[model samples]
Target chain A: MAKMTLDQLRKLREEKKGDMVRREVEGKEIQIIVGMGTCGIAAGAKEAFDAIVQTVDENGIASSVVIRQTGCMGLCHVEPTVEVVMPGMPATIYGRVDAEVARQIVRRHVVEKNLVENHIYDRPAVDIVKK
Target chain B: MHFSVSDFLLDLVQNSIEAGARTVTVRVVEDRGLIEASVGDDGKGMDEAVKAKAMDPFWTDGEKHARRRVGLGIPFLVHALRQAGGDWELESAPGSGTLWRFSFPADGVDTPPLGDMAGLALSAMAFDGDYELVMERRAPARGTEWTVRRSELRDAVGELTDAGSLTLARAFLESQEEPLDGIE
Candidate 1:
């Protein structure tokens, strides 16, 4: 559905370059890691990855968040898993994440400082939701 | 194991990325109902023993957790190719680069589906490294040929590491992929 050319991409990149490339990857405030192994892709991790990318950019937190896709973490059973790590959060990992759930994570968990508790399949068992 | 053709292709390319490859080339050509593909990389090549073992399904590294990595790469690829009545070849050395070439009938009964090509291409481009990935797609029957390069993409999108840049890169890939009517 998208018809992009190098000229168009260059224009779009100019608009985005100044804001997104200001910080190094390790210097970002939040890190979003999506599982993208064969198991994960077959389960639709790419859609989730795209959703997170769009959501973070739309929320104007592109400078603060870094998104990456990693190989299988040996969690093939519950694929399409995503790991979120921020300053005060416990680096929770969510499972069965499609595009919709991915957006909720960025909007609610990353922006509003609330955890998507139900989707979190891995995290320290504690009530760490922001007050 | 039953992923789309693109996914399988991406899996093969991912091995190069994980091996710290600085440049990778992927070529796919479909003409006269035959598909020929190759992935070449300037990554750490395998030695003779390891290279031979890589293609043996029963070979093991003797590590406690070694079961996962074995037979998943070349062995499985050869198995799939055989099932489709195809063949393959791999050439590599410790210092030199690695290249794998294979072919199969496009209409083979077991030819995998070509999944979200944009997604596959994006994922291949976004690996964390100062590298370039060049993908060449050709369809002689349709008189079509196109190439996508990751370095140019990074130059255009600023960087592929973050959400903003990746979203742009993904869109660019989707645009390049004419999925509905063509083999791109």
Candidate 2:
């Protein structure tokens, strides 16, 4: 429902300056994906996609970002889901994702180079509870 | 609440986006003896094995892909169409993309009749520059052939996000159902 303007987009383009570019995969980075299933769509996947793409573009790190799409990742409960892959780092899946969380992922992990522990979906530990 | 074939088309276009397709094309044509809707996207293409299981009622592409959840769309579509006296086809080449072609009796029970088609066509085509969605309607009796593209809307809307611009976008789609130059 939020509408974006060319000037606002351009302003965002300018303010973020060099930091908001898309990651250059040429360096060292992993593939990051947002599940685009039917559930996800109803849950707001497009907004997440826009956030991710906008972050990467604004920062100008085109090479490091490999954005891709996937079918249902089986987590309808978490409707809007995101998966981040980093070399040597375990692939992290985040559920209930929105634009805010997506921005945080880019800021903490992609920029500041630290993962946001609270937002991560720790399934192994959660699986223990099912028993 | 009640969704028509146009709703289904809109839903699938959203699915195509979830599949990570940068661009999606949708076409609906009623020619010869068939009325068909074809949706194609350049997203993550599933392999034969995965593709084979994709349409199964209970088959869900699991964690190897992403979060865990139940998947039941394509199968439902297949069922809904067959009941209406038609068949559905899905084709995909890994790393290339996926194509889903659904055909049903031009006038069938399984197929929800079309509704607010012009609106659906406009909304589906109005994606954010990234995904290009096209909707073509070709019907025999009316000889109506309408094609709507996202780029056209993009050109019209420009960067105007004021209340006026949003209203205009909504109005443009609403107005598309009227008599146009070429189609129908």
Candidate 3:
């Protein structure tokens, strides 16, 4: 197989622009870091990742959520560790994540603008969603 | 905090798990500034089509609507290696297994630095008692290598902690510090 270059991938993505959904970043920009490490993938981070991306697009919540994949966070035990970062707010790392929890993250943190206590990993949490 | 060699290994292991192979072997061999790492699993291997797209960032096989197929882990590492003047390869057979190789300039910033390897080893425990991870490291004249089998840890702990499950969360992290090598 021909190895893919970043430029080639970027071009392919552009050609399929219709299929590409722009995550709403209109509101307060929030960063959702999905641990896509091997362990996280095996544990089903893909499903959870899809749920989060779809929710952000379907809701048209601009400036609402920005998702990206990161390397291992040393919490391999969590398999799927999600770090939610909001401006002026202390980032929270949640473990044992899945699609259901991802929805909760969107509804509660992105919509209702509240933290899902159980999923919040950063202790002594601060207002991570501050504008 | 986001990416590392250990994390890369974990993603390859996912492919192994999907293959239905209960036993997965991971080896990390390093010499001088060169690193050769491979992850192999007895799981169902991918067909030509799947294998072709596996490395495409816009063709994610595991997600419903992933932006690309080249999973972030592979692409990210590829980008990292390229920037560091390194290389990587993916090889697998439908029924045989998958073997991924990543060679990096050990000192390059692009080649992801190794993260808590011990922590990664412990995560293997989470697999169904049948799963296993074999890791090896060689630094030039320093032929000191290491391999950890979930089966062995299960025996040592006297119980399979479902190492990946949330239940063994703390234990999983702690196990990284278990006496595995001369590294205190």
Steric collisions counted per model: 0, 30, 34
Q: Write the per-residue lDDT of candidate 1 for residues B59-132, one digit (tens) a residue.
A: 63433233454335456677788888987888888767789898888889987654666777788887677889
lDDT of 1 by residue, A1-131 (tens): 44578889999878776765663344547989988765677687878888999998888788778788887655566778999999877778988888999999999888877888678785321222223
Best by TM-score: 1
- Tens-place lDDT digits, model 2, residues B41-87: 99888898998787675666654433333456666566667677887
Best by DockQ: 1
- Candidate with more favorable, higher TM-score: 2 or 3: 2
Per-residue lDDT over A58-130 for candidate 2, one digit per residue giving the tens place of the 0 to 100 score:
5655446666556456566675788888766668888878998888876677666677676677453232233
TM-score, chain B, each candidate: 0.85, 0.79, 0.75
lDDT of each: 0.76, 0.62, 0.58
**Every model's TM-score:** 0.81, 0.54, 0.52
Interface RMSD, in order shown: 7.4, 11.3, 20.5
Candidate 3 or 1, higher lDDT: 1
After aligning candidate 3 to the native by TM-score, how far in Å is the CA of B179 from where it should be? 11
Which one wins by lDDT: 2 or 3? 2
Clashes of 2: 30
Relative to the real complex, the DockQ score for model 2 comes to 0.05
Error of 3 at B76 (Å): 2.4
